[model samples]
Target: MEAVHEGEIVDVHALIMSFPASNTGFVVPLPSENQECFLSGLKLLFKQAGGIPLSIRIDNLTPAVKKVRGSEGEAQLTDEFMAFKNHYGFKVQVCNPRSGHEKGNVERKVGYVRYNFFSVPPVIKDFDDLTEQLYQKFLIDRKRMHYRKEAIIEDLWACEQKQLLKLPDNDYSVFKQTTIKFNKYNEFKLDQHLIHVPKAKNYSQLYCITFWNEFKVITNEGEVLLSDARPYMRKRRLIPWKDILKDWVYKPRVVGHSRYREYLPARVREYLLTPSLSLRKQRINEIITLLVQYDMKGINEQFYELISKNDEVVSNPYDVEWSQYDALQPIGGENHEGNH
Candidate 1:
């Protein structure tokens, strides 16, 4: 599926599932067709359907099916997908290669959903928001009369629900676990994104647990170093500036080459880029301390005001009267004077 996401026309994956008996259909839009997305989509489908299907007729998608044996032989499933099936205790019914008629219902439902639900090429601001909207559309669609059956689609679906396998006590853990090494920047590359793991040593091995929407960097001792939302676009970098700024105070030279440098306010960036190494270190240290009490926006605004008033770079952190920035003060009325 192609949709306008954040004003960019990017390709998205749509998982379409349809029940032949009730003529009920489900469609889940995913960011990618990775194993995590495929498995997570199945989990979402099961949740929406209220129970797991006894047998799912599927095409030879790479996420699930690694290889199609032949026209009649059983398809080989990926290890993660095979484990997922075992956990849910469902049966797999792989459709034969080039045999579109075998699962014609879902194939047609895909076209129906593409035209009826996504005909306008939805302007998606948030992926989850789009998903919720589609789910509501499906619910409304179910209220209509079935194409072939006498009863409404929702009514037939209600009767078919009782025949489904009982939902398991616990949901399956859908994630892809792998070992990754942090680069010299204390960041690891996943897809085209550089995910920073603060405090992680450079060139160190760590466990990366990837989910459909987020990923976690784990230490060797199983300590979670960072758990952050994964970026959807390519060539993106996820940097926790506040956390990394603590480390940057010592390595002030590298601040110039930082990918996040341009993102900082102009005055703040100039303050950090000063030729005086000691001043840069002192300023960043103060900024880091201030960040503990206030957000980046507040800090940036205060710095902008201070620079505008002084008309010259504040040589020392102690020169500024921190109390004057009362509007940006932290809650609970904690005195910040002695902290400097």
Candidate 2:
């Protein structure tokens, strides 16, 4: 694990895997150490290697092993880990207790990966991007000749790849799927963070699949209704303000008394509370239309600045040049074409 030396001390855990025979290695960085992280790392390794190893050897980590009986005794593996092993058709071999020496190849890979990739303490903004780039860097190591065998690592891996087991046809989700009934507020709280469900299905039970960094709420029919990209180490509610405002456009009067009213921009709140209901509805509709091309905060901030400074409101809010407000919002992964 390495601490991301930015403002926050975010710890990024690297799951390192190496094939001793081929002298090939794979590393997958995750948010933290957990069952989900383990599963995601293994999935990434399988995708990169193009097949599953005959057997995976690792230290007795709690995520994989529930209990390590003894050198001669059977190792008790976690149910989830066992399921993963069964799906991939790989045998799980746990090193002896306190026997880091037993996994020498993987142990040496820790320093090799660190010195080559993590030594500079990668200046990265997105965890996914950092992991993806580092994986590509790892591929360069394959060009080097093996220390003992004196053969290129890439060529050896190519031969070893054919001997490995093929992946199962089924799609393996690295997250745990569960169901949750939406409360009266049309929302559900996971890990003390409240998330809004779709207004149409307020009271309906949805299938919630929780991942390491995010969660998804799907319909009973398997359609994804919402994808909540949760921020790490933050305990704040994530309400889809755009969705709520869209619904509020039909009933502008509710904008004043709704629980989420305070979250609206000051200018927008004033406009909605205007005594002229027709004008309020018109502006609300305009806001809903603006939501498609711009972020709510950017639109709200720019709108407030214009009305407050100029002492005049645009006759048609949508007609206003929105390009200036575009930069007010941060474009997060909007143009990301890189594959995960």
Best model per lDDT: 1
The sequence of per-residue lDDT tens digits that candidate 2 reaches over residues 219-306 is 7788888886654534223346678877877887787787556445444555566677787777777677666765555665577454
| Cα TM-score of candidate 2 | 0.59
Candidate 2: residue 329 Cα off by (Å): 16
Clashes of 2: 0
Candidate 2 residue spans exceeding 4 A from truth: 1-10, 178-208, 217-227, 231-340
Q: How many steric clashes between backbone atoms does each model show?
A: 0, 0
lDDT of 1 at 108: 90
Which is the leading candidate under TM-score? Answer: 1
lDDT at 206, model 2: 78
Tens digits of lDDT, candidate 1, 137-212: 9999999998887899999999998888888898788888898877778877986877887777742578999999
Off by over 4 Å in 1: 2-11, 71-73, 123-125, 182-187, 196-204, 233-340
* lDDT of every predicted structure (CA atoms): 0.74, 0.71
Q: Measured by TM-score, how close is model 1 to the native structure?
A: 0.64
Error of 2 at 15 (Å): 1.1
